[model samples]
Target: MCEEATVSLADVVQEDEQLQEEASAVLAGSDSERCSYPQGYVKRQALYACNTCTPKGGQAAGVCLACSYKCHEGHQLFELYTKRNFRCDCGNGKFADAPCKLFHAKDDVNGLNKYSHNFFGEYCTCRRPYPDPEDQEDDEMIQCVLCEDWLHGRHLGCDVPDHVESWEMICEACMNTHAFLWRYAARLAGKRRENVLRDLTDPPASDPVPGAAVESDAAKETTADETDGATEPSRKRVCPEEAEAKPGCGLEALQNAGAERPGSGAVFWPPGWRSRLCRCDACQASLAAAGLSFLPDESDTVLAYEKKGRSEEGGAPGHDPLMSALDNLSRVQQLEIIHGYNDMKSELKDFLQGFVAEGKVVTSADIRQFFERQQSRKRRRADDRFHCA
Candidate 1:
């Protein structure tokens, strides 16, 4: 459905009572899938699962959403899902209304929290945990779109565009490889842009070599400026031929990192970028030795799914829900202990096998009255025995 179907406030209130009554029956054994809620214990709604109660060898059991905080709050949860076709088990023998075990969300039961890089409790190039509220306050971390690694604001240097609103961000390695195309993409147009992204890549004229020598005139002016406390006007530029042929430099080999040489005619940027992040042999060797890449994947952060995917909306507003909170007594035991079970079950089975039976409404209060009457009879019998003696 598109929008949330608006529900009437009065109708919801009416349903609330029926919902509880129906839910109680389901927990008591009307629903075959659930054992019934233990007698005398009424429960709230069902919308969350408790991974802590998962049997060592059996299926996981669930309680109501409120029970998460009310009962199993500190216990590791199964990332909360809608309790479809199931009943709440709170206050039942299985759940027994245990107090929630958690003091904080971050202190999840083992494997309870989503796992990924964050499982190690550290992220990004800075190797810090996502800023915890318990620790001192800190800056927000930005995730790189291409590599999917998180980084603090200061570590990424000053290359990210200040006005980036639509386009995704890449790591330094990817930006270096695709900088040429990103800069002059409109100028390159169709085939030329592809070619540039693929092969015959140009060296960045803008980047300065770490240790290139300066011309004598420029060096002389620099010394004079230092002595006079004046600044030099401009620096000399290296011609294209000299840069391309810089002894150990390999402008031609960069084509392999970026594109097919001639007949093969395959593109390389995206694929190359991924292999490099995975530390494939060619990418590792090329990047490690030469500080460059072919190109990188637009979305390299596949690990996000394992961590964030579980936390998506667990349930939505709906007219119907599930509840089944029952005890696990043997049939003979239930027969001996619960005089009303047989009667309740027979009536429960007739309504399309659902929980709500006709006429009688059984809530926790009814069970309380039944026990009170039994105790009252016991006291009267003791008075009669004393008089006879």
Candidate 2:
């Protein structure tokens, strides 16, 4: 016989709590009340694309969170997640019919904002939307830290590594565009992607993997045995002993390096890899030339922006007080309490709806008066019961 799925009260409550947390994380860096246009190119903020205004094959555009709610309400929107150095493009020559309700003034165009395929409600290498109807496999998509574009695991050109939370992924497109990163991959990123790059490069049959550096403080020389994936008949590679003195030598070694191999695949760089990048004068110039000056700045990261948002909102609730209090009661008592709570919540919502229908603003004094009326009704019921007894 088939069995019915059962869920305990604690399990239900925990699932609801988890859902709330996920929502909070997704909205951590978004401001829903005020327009972000005045900010002028925010380092990082949650963004949305309006298909109703700029549909597929049209000029791509994105708007800030507040614009999504106040201006693009009832319109189809694609959540672009957190984008770096983005400015709101709502009603800025892009939306001729939709004037922003929150902010009046706007430039004809936000020249700095970059738009990708995601702006038109498309994603992944396949260019399909999330929860795609054509796709049957239940694969998860991951956002590239550099491009901010989401890609399915199958399209990443490498196996998704375990414990992905501990590292940040840079897609192959970004990796090849800023090829210097490949020089650091062997030392800082996971072996999976690095191995792919090595296979594509096909370094001098049995020669040590190019750009693979030995991490040490005292060792002056490194043999092929010390390098990752290096085989026997090992060749000795000389490098600076002091870690501080190594960046120049390392970068110089790869100065004459040929064109970076395409399809090297996406690489998962471990934590602290950003700080480990060579910040020497030559490297800095190279970064600037490639328009990746923000790469070294921690403040430019999405995590940092989300943290700022959480701090401004006084942080997410650590625990629900009502849930904690309910834990002390029996299951029957818990159910009764929850039922009462639900009735009150529903009634209160309906009460508020009356004011909303009349376009009336709810105030603190109004809430106090509401509770006072409830108390008076309870007293009248008690008096009627006393008289009957």
Candidate 3:
């Protein structure tokens, strides 16, 4: 059995806040409009800083690279230069209201946040940032369609162990898309398709394993160009009630979709999509019984309608309608959670990137180990603080 992880109150609040803020960002368009991105994504700059936040120290501007994600999340931030020598402004000047939330060592190792930082200026075989007038080459650097980062011909695809064997690369930001899609496709006709996926990262094996649906992140990524990540949905987002009304979520409908088609007898919808795309009460109960969670539909149409509905109708005043549940969701399950269980999975995945990104035999043990590692990290961090103090 998978290590059981459940949701708690704190998790719900955090996710609610995040969802509301994201909704606000989408509806009102915060500083996001002025934000410059790597085509479809955002690139970090050492000089980038957010003027928001209630100056913890006395600082309002000049935020440092180390404290950006923590200090500037959901804020309108701007970028300046690429100075490498400038020190972090986290605890100095008007910013001294409190210690840096990211790094506890105020003086050691320059107190920086490197965990999520993208430390790249340029990429490709040429090794220069894009639009270099000095190079004058028409051949361009490969820009990843997922993360939108420019990549070197050899160093593309994923960051650590990602299969970097192709120019049409889909970065890690969207690697999960293919995993979920594979699962859906496998159950499409209620049959497991053998070797439906091929690994793009590794050289071809003479006699590969038969019926292998998952290859690796690199293999899953071959389907990324046509698929969308959790944040980017290609279909209309509907309520859970709406989803059950369709096929897949309901067992009978699922069987119907899988029923034999005489030269395409029935127009079958993709399997598991009913649950994957719904957020209604009925779908919530169904997924709960199956030990799964709701991955809310985030299509623009859905977001817009929700924003409008919330504005006009308001939330359940006294009921506090149960807002779905998620545990150690299958990686192939695209339901993105916000806190506790949702966040626990993310933290664990971050810790065990190597394990999570391995070839497609991700088992319940893999999921259990992921959670165990998270507990170990937390305990280790607490121990270090006690020893240092």
Candidate 1 lDDT, 1-389, residue by residue in tens: 69855544344547997776444432322222332232212221224455566433333445544555556657666432221223454443444334333222211222221222432344566666555455465654555543444565556653333322212335454455544323222222123122322222232543222112212232232223223344334434554455435443222333334532222111112211221122235434655454333223222222212112222212323322211222566777656545555544454345322223233444567557656865787689779999999
lDDT, model 2, position 139: 89
lDDT of each: 0.37, 0.70, 0.37
Error of 2 at 236 (Å): 27
Worst window of 10 by summed lDDT in candidate 3: 264-273
lDDT of 3 by residue, 1-389 (tens): 89766554345546998887554433332122222211211122234444454322322344454355565667655443232223455444434454556544444223332211122333443456445667654543444432334544444332222222222333333334323322332333222111122221221332121112222232233335423233332333233343234333322332334533222111112212222232345545654664333122222122232344345434335422223333445544534333445577577556555543442344568778776877898799789999998
The superposed Cα distance between candidate 3 and the true structure at residue 326, in angstroms, equals 60
Best by lDDT: 2
> What is candidate 1's CA lDDT for residue 327?
51
How many clashing pairs in candidate 2?
Answer: 0
**Could you tell me every candidate's TM-score relative to the true structure?**
0.24, 0.67, 0.24
- What's the true lDDT of residue 169 in model 2? 87
lDDT of 3: 0.37
The weakest ten consecutive residues by lDDT in model 1 span 263-272
